[model samples]
Target: MFGGPYPWSLYCGQWSILPPAPKGNYLKDKVVVITGATSGVGLEASKQFADASPEQLIFAVRSVEAGEKLLGQIRKAHPNLQDKVMYLDLTDLQNIKDFSEAIKVFGRVDILINNAGINPNFDEGPYKSTKDGYERVFQTNVLSPFLTTLLLLPLLRKSSDPKVIFTGSDVHHIAPSDLIETALQNGQSIISAYNDEGKYHNPTRYYESKLLLQILSRNLIKTLPDITTINVNPGLAMTNLGRDFNLSLSPSGIVGILWFVANARSASKAARNLTSAAA
Candidate 1:
């Protein structure tokens, strides 16, 4: 049963009916780029795009090995589909720069999907900072994506209709005033703002970061008028993000996870929203 204001029937009634796979090569001859394409909704979106027969599909991933493995699977399924794997570690500013520069070699980029993100579990110790001295969640979910989108603008401009999709979450609806107040009170020091031991909660931090992304998406339209920038909230789906939490270890965790599994949409179904946005 739904626990929030909505009744179970109302929540269940809103479940997305999967849209039919796109017809007739909508992405034909266009280049599609996706970050974090090795797993979860990113991987599902990649599979969905592959079926559309794009001229080239590039994956910007942290692990070339994992990217290669996914590429192989896609190739096995669609032998003629052109694809490549590139390295991109969102936590590192230099990696984002290098990856963006590397992507420029392509004549044009029709679509850029910023789907990579991290939601550190509650059990994952105190808040961590990225190599760039920013909070890990903030850098991974917002800063890096912002930088990458800017760097890729020229390439995106080459296309007749360029689209940038930012993966967002419904959790962003949670008020961020406290987070803003904390950041201001801390003089915007990433460590000081997010490292409060008593206040640290991964899900809360993740929501704050996503809320920042949604704000960015709204402003992007004013700054980059030609490009289509949109933030998409893929409904909750079962994914490896929960690996760190052992549901079997606690009765409550078991029940909670089971309830989620029973109610949440599948990754593939959630991914349709992403692919549909891109198309």
Candidate 2:
């Protein structure tokens, strides 16, 4: 059941028995950077890394205020956590470039975790595009992360054993291909295809984006053999991911809640996968 055309071996097996987080101060001299560290899996991964005692931990978040608040909470427990929170809005390509340049102050990045993502509810309205003229979800989940990794490659290469990690998902296996086929048939670029409001499908957008991300991660492995690139499937987790869905106490919201209850694990537990991959 775990291994087939849709191989769940690596995904399901790992979820069933998550790798143990490092126990010692192994990251003493390493500079680790994580995006979306103020919430959900990102927040928990930040905490886990903090406990491990990294030389430097940077949180690339959308809000500096929220990042700092999270840092304060972490400091309360560790009392000596060396961390900084910087603003990084994945919705804007320019903002991602600016954030990457700002990271130069840290010199080198040993671990870069592109953990931030979004799943907008298509049920609410038609597809919306970012200022960069890409679909909001596509830009946030795929393009921005790809750009961040590209910009940070030079710094990551400077490290002895630099690693780049993407928080992928299992749903990618079930993502539809008809959208892509239709895009190709119409001779539209991948970006333009996804940006097309007529072609927008809520159930498939996130899955397709993640599938694309995993594909990119694999290419990184081949092209950048020196850097250890991995796409980690964190499994379903109960986080603020659905905050955009605006799930109130309505009938649909009740169904959404039930879906989470049956399928999603706690964010803290799910975050172990991220930390393990980073370690």
Candidate 3:
């Protein structure tokens, strides 16, 4: 749905949504850590994993309050699930490092889902850089995940069936070569290109980040043979990823919504795919 071809059934509206994750203790006693678990596909996937009975479900989030609220909701529904919150702001490299180090206390990490990301929308002005001096989209979507996955490798190795999951997009296929070449040649900085208002589109930057993520996942599997690394596109879903779009206030936004509804899957349906990948 995100700029790639898919079976017509996904866009047809008549196809039956996949049922909720199968009932079982598939993740029983396993330690699961998910970034961006406070909302959207991440939140839904957390619920599904909770139902599967993971021993520990830790959410590494930017907002502790939001994470606590989500944890409360999940606990209310599934009181027996063990879910906790840890602070992680991908915009800050130190926060990522601290979070990864804290994970060591858990002893083992059976599943790691790098599901957090951002799409600033077409209207958001000038490029923003992270505290680490990297472009915001590039750091949040690609570099942070790369670093987090690497830092957690030792913990992941402690588990019998360790798996790392990366949330990717079909939009990756459309990443412009000019941008890729520029970033590569200029030493990992896409800010110059992103700041060029005349040539930059928010979607393009987002797509490029996803493309980089897929590249990271592919290369990781070659070296880390003990852990299974998987990249998955959860299809286009109605989520807060488009919070910046302000669709209700503009004509183009309305058209965008209509197009999304026709082609996108719901967050719950997308979560099914994510949880299945983890299982």
C-alpha lDDT of all candidate models, in order: 0.82, 0.84, 0.82
How well does candidate 2 score on lDDT at residue 266?
79
lDDT comparing candidate 3 with the true structure: 0.82
C-alpha RMSD (angstroms) for model 1:
3.1
Residues 1-279, candidate 2, lDDT per residue (tens digit)?
111234465346435865566678867889999998988999998999999889899999998999999998999998877889889999999998898899999999999999999987535456788898898989999999999999999999889999999999887777777767877898878777778888888756877898888778889899999999999887778888867665578776677677557656778888988988876
Steric clash count of candidate 3: 0
TM-scores of the models, in the order given: 0.88, 0.90, 0.87
Cα-lDDT of candidate 1: 0.82
- Cα lDDT tens digits, model 3, 1-279, are 232344453444325566567678899989999999988999899888888889999999999999999988888888888778999999999888888888899999999999999987745457677777777888899989999998998999999999999999766776766876867787875556654556656656787788889888999999899999999878778789988654563675666667777767779888887899987
Candidates ranked by TM-score, best first?
A: 2, 1, 3
Identify the candidate with maximal lDDT: 2
- Flag regions of model 2 displaced more than 4 Å: 1-15, 122-124, 182-188, 246-256
Model 2 residue pairs with clashes: none
Show pairs that collide, candidate 3.
none
The best candidate by TM-score is: 2
Candidate 1 local lDDT, residue 129: 79
Q: Would you give me the overall lDDT of model 2?
A: 0.84
Please tell me which model should have the higher TM-score, number 1 or number 2: 2
Worst 10-residue stretch by lDDT in candidate 2?
1-10
